[model samples]
Target: MIKVYGITTCGSVKKALSFFKAKVIPYSFVDLKTTQISEETLEEWLSKQPLLRLFNTKGTKFKTLNLSKELSDEAKKEWLLKEQLLFKRPIVECEDGALLVGFDEELYLRTFSS
Candidate 1:
């Protein structure tokens, strides 16, 4: 089963959920606001996706923190743990163990259409 992690208010998350529904793909949504993501899960996702890819530098959260300046990988990791909203919406962990950071129709089709 695919596991989707993001907040409910995010448009990207909604789009991802809609795409899954339209394709009849089985998925479980994990709302970040309600259920906190564990460090273990963060480590697992980081293993598959680069720390840069997982980090959302353009989001409001990042803007609020003003993290655009050069920062070490450890700093970024700490920020990610401190602000989950700084993560790109709808991080999808596919049944095949593929980690996708955002919603791209073509990529989704290619990954899940089998």
Candidate 2:
């Protein structure tokens, strides 16, 4: 099953969920506000995508924390593990085990339309 991770208030997350609903693709939503992500899950995402990709540098949480690019990978990971809002919205676990971060309509069409 496809599982999406993000808070309901996130626009990107809303877009992703809407895409799935419009496509008639089945998916489970995991609200980041309620769910806790584990180290193993973060490690798995990092295995598929880069640490920078998983990190949300543009979000309010990042700006609020005043994170810098100089932060080490370990430091970033620690922040992500502690702060769920720092995750890029709508992290989708695709059926094939690929992790999709954020929302792009073209990419969504290509990935899910198949």
Candidate 3:
């Protein structure tokens, strides 16, 4: 089963979930608003994906926080830990230990299509 982490109200998260449901893919959703992801888990994801990919720079949360775009990797990671909304929407953890951040229709099709 795929593990998807993000808030439900996010448009990208909604798209990802809809795609999964449409494809009949089995996935478990972890709402970031209700659940907190640990630093260890975030680090694991960061190892698989670039920090910029996992960290959402364009989101309203980022803008609202008035964070500097030139933040160092460590600073970014610290901010991510401090705010769950700073994460890119719909981070998917595949059974093969692959991590995907955000929704891309083509990527989802190629990866999840049976």
The per-candidate count of clashes, in order, stands at 0, 0, 0
TM-score of each: 0.93, 0.96, 0.97
Q: Write candidate 1's Cα lDDT for 1-114 as tens digits.
A: 999999988988999999999999989999877777778888999999998899888788888887764788888888788788978888999888989998898999899886
Worst 10 residues of 3 by lDDT: 105-114
TM-score of 2: 0.96
Q: Model 3: which residue pairs collide? A: none
Cα lDDT over the full model 2: 0.92
Poorest stretch of ten by lDDT in candidate 1 = 62-71
Cα RMSD for candidates in order? 1.2, 0.9, 0.8
- Model 1 stretches astray by more than 4 angstroms: none
Clashing pairs in 1: none
Name the candidate that leads on TM-score.
3
Residue-wise lDDT of candidate 3 within 9-35, one digit each (tens)? 999999999998998899999999888
